[model samples]
Target: SNLETETEKLIQIVLIGQPELDQLLKKNELRQLRQRITISWELLPLNRDETRGYIQHRINVALGKGRVQFSRSAVELIYKYSHGIPRMINVLADRSLLIAYTMNTKKITPKIVRPAVKDVGGLNPLTTWIDSLWKTILPGFLALSILLFGANYLMLPDFNKKNVEEKDLNLIIKENPIIPKNLIISNSQAPIIDLPQSGNLALEKMKPVTPSHQAYTPDDSLTTKLLNPRRIPSTKPLIIS
Candidate 1:
């Protein structure tokens, strides 16, 4: 009667376990009481696109619905550094926010994200390894490349011609590689005038010309000059009485 009642009121039970537990169960060292059941769903890490939302969610929680912005570059860097793990994202985000706050910054820039990721522990080992590759290995690699290039350059055979005699060398030293197109050669053209020789040859533009003085005195007879020039005869009005 109890078995019949249990069958009539059967409740669906779900179990969640990791791959190691499954392996143990298969080895018979560990066993599920109900035996074989279906594996329905597999959860995977959040992807890069999802990680942005995840970070925003955590940041929203932290800010109590206030507005604090994350630069797009900062978000991309966080995604790359965290590899889309929620826990690592949380750690990096928290550290980054703390860093930004301590630095009195309002937005999370890429510069802030990089330092925060480096400082945060529990980040994926691969991410840390890649970061280290950039920090330590890259400079060394660049130096090695430069060294190799220099060595290759040095090893090549010298193709230089033999040095000329002293007289020839002197002549070569005095000789200009480029001939002046406008040399003052004796010709029909007038001989160039001797320019005023000085360390500072004053350019035509540099000479300062004195400005013309303007007489701007106000005339006392301004009103009469405009209309009626009321002039008095200078010779006592020619008193011919």
Candidate 2:
């Protein structure tokens, strides 16, 4: 004011400060100064995409072709917490990078940024709520998912084994039309036979059958059917003892 009064040439005065300066000048005591101000321009905060580009630009200038990078999630968190203020962005970004460095990682993520935000303090209620939500909810959800996956993985083999056993049982029943009532198929035991004495004559006429990995001694009823000297496939031979 003194300089302008002395010069009498309408000197221009520029006030550059944080947004708080606007509220400061709006106070009752500063009404005269506020009214006398010739012009006022407030710098708007950067938006989400602009904040990303700004951060990337700074990183590129500092690192050149370095491998260090910020994940999109981390950038989003930074934008949320800083509300696109450049100085706050710098603070959060720097802290996040430092946190990542301590953890021996070149990439900054929301996990790293969360801790950095806490360490820097001055978080708004919404940001704090989000931080708490992630800290508590995300881990529990992931753990549940992993547990469910593990349970499903563990149960799959048993289900497949049961199906295979059933299929094997059905195939055995289909291939051998006459199965003894006492014949039992189990994992630990092979098929058993209860032969009757009525088909001894037919058994003697039957040729000595080839051995196989799966050999079943048939009932007297099956021995009667073998009396007809028909061609049997070698792969699916009926063994009788």
Cα distance off (Å), candidate 2, residue 86? 2.5
Off by over 4 Å in 2: 4-13, 63-67, 125-241
Cα lDDT of model 1 by residue, 90-158, tens digit: 778888888999999878999898889778755543355677789999999999999999998899865
Over the stretch 121-153, how does candidate 2's per-residue lDDT look in tens digits? 977623557788999999999999999999999
TM-score of 1: 0.40
- Give the C-alpha lDDT of model 1: 0.66
User: What lDDT score is found at residue 186 in candidate 1?
Assistant: 40
The 10 consecutive residues of candidate 2 with the worst lDDT sum are: 232-241
Q: TM-score: which candidate is best?
A: 2
TM-score of each: 0.40, 0.44
